[model samples]
Target: MFFSPLDQFEIKPLLILNNSYILSLSNYTIYFILVILIIYGYTIIFKNNKLSSNRYGVAIIALYDTILNLVVSQIGRQGGYYFPLIFSIFNIIVISNLLSMIPYSFALSAQLVAVISLSLALWIGNLIIGLYIHGFKFFALFVPSGTPLALVPVLVLIESLSYSSRAISLGLRLSANILSGHLLLLILGSLILSLISTSLIGFIGGIIPVIGVVAIVILEFGISIIQGYVFSILLSGYIKDSILLH
Candidate 1:
């Protein structure tokens, strides 16, 4: 068995439903459980007495914060209309990432399946939203707001590549950052543990590693929120540009 802190994240089958696939749960169950906890936690945050009220408050705050940040950073004051979608996406991503920090938890953000699903959903959803808002004009997103007529062919090809690449890039951005950070924590911790025995020198070496591990944990916690925010901001920016022709 691996000795890293994250080694406990292995998946175990809960039931074998079929030959090809089995229903299994992962140590990361804690993360998903925390998500449920967060539902109640929000009630506390917003001082809402009822679960329904808390859910509503959570939705409202998430949407407003995400949209407000996107407007300030990427789209300016004119980006207010996109807040609802942006906020929902931001809340989900932020909550998902944060939930992964619990012991034996799986960071679904590290999985391509989870990340790709999220990106694809956002892409398709935004495309639909843009179409709904702009009608046939949404297709115009394929064309740049400004380009020399002669360069339209090259620009179109470039834009197409960029458009398709968004899903992969967005997914990879979160997955890579999360996986690498966790892996680094594991490696450094193991290396420290290996250098010294469990005796005095070992304990001394472990002190440094313990501190390092704590720092890494804290750093990942911060990054979990940041990754979610970045994903939300980018989504908002994309929508703003698509709608405003920026």
Candidate 2:
């Protein structure tokens, strides 16, 4: 049987709610709920508990410290106020990415629509903050610090385009990386299966692709974590720009 790598991305309905309106629960919804539950459970477990001498507690503390340091370094002391938001974003992305590595699990972050919606929301929120703080002066973002009077309109247009593209670019980067990595894994897996099924000789030869699959899987895991970090860093940078108007 020929397996379609793209089939993994299909959004199949799991439970129908209202057939007339085509309302139904899908894998995405279930996985989203699971993500929420996991986050909630972790918080509940670690919320008020004293940090134990165990490695688990120490690891958690290190992660918390790393995130706090990142926010403070990137967005300054004022960024401390936004630590919860930044932490939530980082955890959600990291968890979703990690969950997608599970066999037969849906990759929520790989969905362009979902990622773009999040990016647009964050981008708009940052815009609102900037405008609220700077009022009309926020529009100054479109004009470079030093430019000829004749180039004002052109520079503003260019700047406006670049600024607006952030949402699309950020989302596209995450979705593209996740989608490609998963697709490559699926292809390699299918190759291994096909080779194994062909003949005894083919089965022996299948070891090569199997090894490739294992290596790629490890690489994908690292990529997933790095992507989450990258997303958080970019958000922090955006927050910095919003606050400093630079």
Candidate 3:
């Protein structure tokens, strides 16, 4: 049991080694493995030959269509080639966020380090993609059209800072949302426990918080989906900007 709401975020070592904790497994490793297995199972379902013959497969196809449309709309015909990458990103993140809501489960998306690392990698990958395709032309990204001569350097510096900040801000958006939502749920759960365990009057009033908890759970689920979609869209846009100068 957690003594405080923040206690749930504490990392606990799951495996002990011979006097050396430097490489021991932890809760994060276990949960990441679980998430990987879940993603692997989902890929198996996606690969089944008879997938299109069932309702689940139909839904899967619909989701694929949505993603395809998103990629094409944002990145154009070239974007179709990157569908696999975006699909993996969306799946891993959505699954991680959803599975974390399960009781006693570790929330990978809530971890700042993990989220920021992913964002930083994506940002770097985008840079590589841009430079690979356009070479020195990629530097044009920092320049704005119709800029006055005196303001060119100032605008370039400002643009560069804002562009680089996306790596941190993008991941922070998801991590902060997950952390805040989980904190809220924990607080409400504790409140309900205290209320129901109090006097008879408090027990009766506990129903209110129970309902609130249910509502918040539903809201969090919506947020999980929305965050996945938002991440995909923003990533697509970033990739688009990288690939296409100006």
* Whole-model lDDT values for every prediction: 0.70, 0.87, 0.87
For model 2, residues 1-246, the per-residue Cα lDDT tens digits are: 114556457777778876742788877888889998998877764765666667777777787888899999999999899999989988888899999998777899999998999999999999999999999899898998888999999999999999999978888899999999999888778778989999999999989878888999999999998998899899999988888888
Could you tell me which residue pairs clash in candidate 1? Answer: 28-106, 63-87
For each candidate, give its TM-score against the true structure. 0.75, 0.92, 0.92
TM-score of 2: 0.92
156 in model 2: Cα distance from truth in Å?
1.1
Candidate 3 on 1-246: residue-level lDDT in tens?
434556446677878798578978877787788878987876777778899999988888888889889999999999988898998888888888898787777788899998999999999999999999999999889989888999999999999998899898889999999899999998889889999999999999999889989999999998987888888998999999999875
Worst 10 residues of 2 by lDDT: 1-10
Mind sharing the TM-score for model 1? Answer: 0.75
Prediction 3 TM-score vs. true: 0.92
In model 3, the runs with Cα more than 4 Å from the true position are: 1-8
RMSD of 2: 2.3
Better by TM-score, candidate 2 or 1: 2
